[model samples]
Target chain A: MSAVASMRDSILRADTRLSKYHPLSRILFYDDFDEGVNGWCELVGNHAGNLDDIREIARDFRPPQLSSCTFFDIGTHGSIEGTYSLKLATRAVPNHAAIAIKRLTYMRRGLVQFETYFTFKAEQTFDRAALSGWDGNKAPSERQFGDFSFSNDICDGENGKRYMGLVRYLNTDVDGNLVQKWMHKTSVQPTTRMERQGVVPPNQDFHTVNPDDWEEIPGGNQPLCFNETASKVNWHYLKWIMDTSRRRMVELQCNDNVMDLSSIEVPVYDGHYHGLPNLLNFLLDVRTRTNVRNFLYLDSVLVSVDW
Target chain B: MLRRSFTAVLEKNSTFTSDFATEPYEAGWALEARWFVRILEISPGAGLTMTAQISPDGLFWCDEESGPFCLNEVGLASMPLRNFGQWLRLDARLSGKNPHVKVLIYLAVKG
Candidate 1:
């Protein structure tokens, strides 16, 4: 383990504290059918207005990929500011079969105002040393950042020799019981494939021939964590198998955004207008905030696709 | 297409009246801007009227220049004349304390 000693010789105390900040609110998933001008779009809950956390009942979780997932808890008859958005990059993924699969769950807020669906897929040769276990090798900051921002390094090294991703905005609605579901498909399974993946070491000596069996890599606080970040680090590899299965999963989310409009505190009112005289009091084409919204369930299985 | 119901004040602006001349002023520029009109609350009595005026050199006005185009209906309306310059001024002109009007018009070319 001499190679492991050199990297940790000088441990520079590092403080990577994440500051407290606010996340932007997203408005997706809703049925804007009736409620002409002003109305509430709340995805009401069942029973005594109490929300139940039944994960076991939520059979259709999203794809089992190890992508970062966030859950938001919202309220009824009020407003909420979400700190996340669905990050599914549909265009980049490849569905050799007609259908794709993913695991998903409702994190927060139900019966939302609207929702955008996206799909993503990626694959790497088990032999690509430039890649392979890079997810565990790269700084946690970069990996998490790739989930939302444009810092995706999935295919940075190789031009177009990879496939990995998620798609978003599958479905949406305004008011009613909201549910969150994962992507699923029922088709022929792809053949099995394997690879001889390896780990990079700071000190070749400590990483290579330290017959002590499991020799620790020489590094104080390395950004990349080998051994610990496995293919199934948290059911990540399960996603691989899930995608290859003929029967996939379905996921859904619900929010509380649709309003009852009548409940709105209308400060001033001159009764309802009909004819040409009704050309006042409208805030049209202006992006405005709403009362509530939520995510709904995956209505059905994706039986077909064009691309 | 979802639309909101609201109310706005439609006021009458400066009017004009002018006669046509042979020298002919540059009869260029058409009207084209579709400012959305909010219908907060309406009744059967009210009407939307667009006013315009005729100009000689655009400096002079006449009885042939100014008049009103009643929208006839009670909902939203779009008033844009191809030869908007044939008239001098109207209320549809986008200028005032709260210049919130959009008129979309296309004019013909002179041979």
Candidate 2:
């Protein structure tokens, strides 16, 4: 309790918005997918294989490990009561498992916040393999998957540029200390390359900004790894705030802790000829299988506009 | 914003094209809106071409892009409709060898 209090005290009053604004829209259609994946569409060509992997878990299926976290409470209180959470996994083939809400039109540049609860199953453990190719048994060295953003024009086909909404990528360094990066696409354009058309090469039509170019989200030096560890099994609550009108990430909060990322610019669509994400869509991508048996549970998701 | 979603199925070896329009709005409003497209499900190794064309009068239509965007996976794709037109429809052609697949597309505009 004292630790949570200290974390709260550290976040300046100006950076906090949990209590001020009420949720205007859930944003995530079929929020819990209780409607049986009706409003969601898959992007992976292996749709049959991917669809089967996206399942739903009943509410009260697991205790709320994140009850003590303020951000967690904000999302739960704002979401549809007693709704089922999503269980997305990268099972069977190694391809990423993902689903996006069908409604795409939404204001990208606005005062908005996205909150959700995600955690690894108790049986799962970390397995660091190479970055390029998947090792049959383990995930790539860079565990940079989940919560993708092709929904916006950041993936404009013409320039092969990507303007992502939110990307959570985590990995461990040589010293075994957990290293994580949170990224969002700003209006800044990357140097263009050849556009060969459909499913072109990596950087061809979809320019992935260099890791160094991405704004860094500050995480305390403590090791925050999600695996078999009992304490870490608790749900990790995440919150993202953006002022699309200003085109920048206003702030980001993990659990009760808030960090000011006001310097990070939000992606602009002024010169993006291919188009931009006019819709507020979300997706899940588990690019690698954590273990022979493992699952990722999403307790809840809430999106609101305050301003 | 006014947002609506539509679903259609492309049977095996068949082509499907359906028309959907933006929520009818007053003049100069639709021009400020944008449209997003997502192909929900396509059978394995299925080659489906998904295209969005615009019509000012709903009689004559033109391709939104140079060629139809091919779908082989599950993900989100979008296009800005600064002044594209009033009516838009999806044109999908399925690769006969693959099984039938369902398509889910969403349209959103500023309220």
Candidate 3:
């Protein structure tokens, strides 16, 4: 069997060796889609097709309050011979301000059918809101080009002032369909609408921007100190952490514990190397398929991030 | 302050020596003088000095002799500092029955 199939079977069976590496705070679709999973996903506008098919299988099960959560996946692409569609629902505390979290991972096996280079076909999406029912206007965060700056604009609740933010989400639906949805600011916060899922604020990302350090600027409708580049990247990265689970989350030894587990996966794909160079790829393909075919490894993980 | 390509390096090793160094200030790279040059590894009793030798292109020199030091007012030799920093070179010698046989030199420039 391919590595992908080997990995997926081990995970689905909750094999102790692999399961021990991921101590899930809760399992939303352990056996079948449970009412609790449906209830919480629905709170964020997720429906039958929105949660994984397994969630439909676990329509009545539930778990407990979370201190922390870890996840893993060993699967393949939709067409890859080793692809196994695995879905999990659990609490995720992403940062200091997180109230709750839900994470999902769709992984494809690394194939050396022709060469050893791991090929991954994966996609994930989710949403969030910083605050609620505020008069603050939003611009939908347009695509930032060069030298972007954020003006003084409050996006979260502070001093009882209301500000609602929305995170539009798009993900593969339960029936293998893809869906788009949106959630109110607090939808991803401390408690899910049904209070079944969320990071619980105990294991969350930063709750509030430091007023003194990130004061509002004189610019129109922006934060005191905001970089479109840094902000957007960080937001998406955090979003990725919030919605995706990896194959090995225990690798991170952070004392605080709020970390991105998907980061630990044995790469099936990546986009680094100071921006991938396409010119040498043809040569790489030839070499990778020849003497290097079965020997192809991820070579390295792009874990070092710049903020 | 608006600083460009700003960098900071406290000191790889604090062994003061005689060398003219320049770097950008991190605090006030915009308008305020934040890019400060410092001399490290100075003796307590050994007096510190930075003679500002100026040249049209900073090659041929003339001494303007004024620089800061991380030494006490009573003179560096009077009370040696294990590590030191200032916007000027620290001209001092390390001696006395102590074990400091190896010293490293470093420089940090605004790139």
Identify the candidate with maximal TM-score.
Answer: 2
DockQ, in order, for the candidates? Answer: 0.02, 0.02, 0.00
Candidate 2 on A136-217: residue-level lDDT in tens? 4343322433222222222333453334455444333223334554544432323222222222222311213333344445
Output the lDDT of residue A13, model 1: 18
Proportion of true inter-chain contacts also present in candidate 2: 0.00
Judge candidate 1 against the unseen true structure and give its global Cα lDDT, from 0 to 1.
Answer: 0.20
lDDT of 1 by residue, A1-307 (tens): 3755433332211211101111112222221112211221111112232123211111111111111222111111111112111212111111111111221222331221112222221111123453555555442212211111000001112122111212112111112111112211111111011001122222111111221222111121112111122111111100011111111211222121221211111111122212212110100000001121111111111111111
TM-score sort, best first: 2, 3, 1
How good is model 2 by TM-score? 0.43
Question: Candidate 1 regions off by >4 Å?
Answer: A1-164, A167-307, B1-111
What DockQ does candidate 1 have relative to the true complex?
A: 0.02
Please tell me which predicted candidate would have the highest lDDT against the true structure.
Answer: 2
Docking class of 2: incorrect
Cα lDDT tens digits, model 3, A190-228, are 212222332132211111222111211111121111122
Residue A49 C-alpha lDDT in model 3:
53
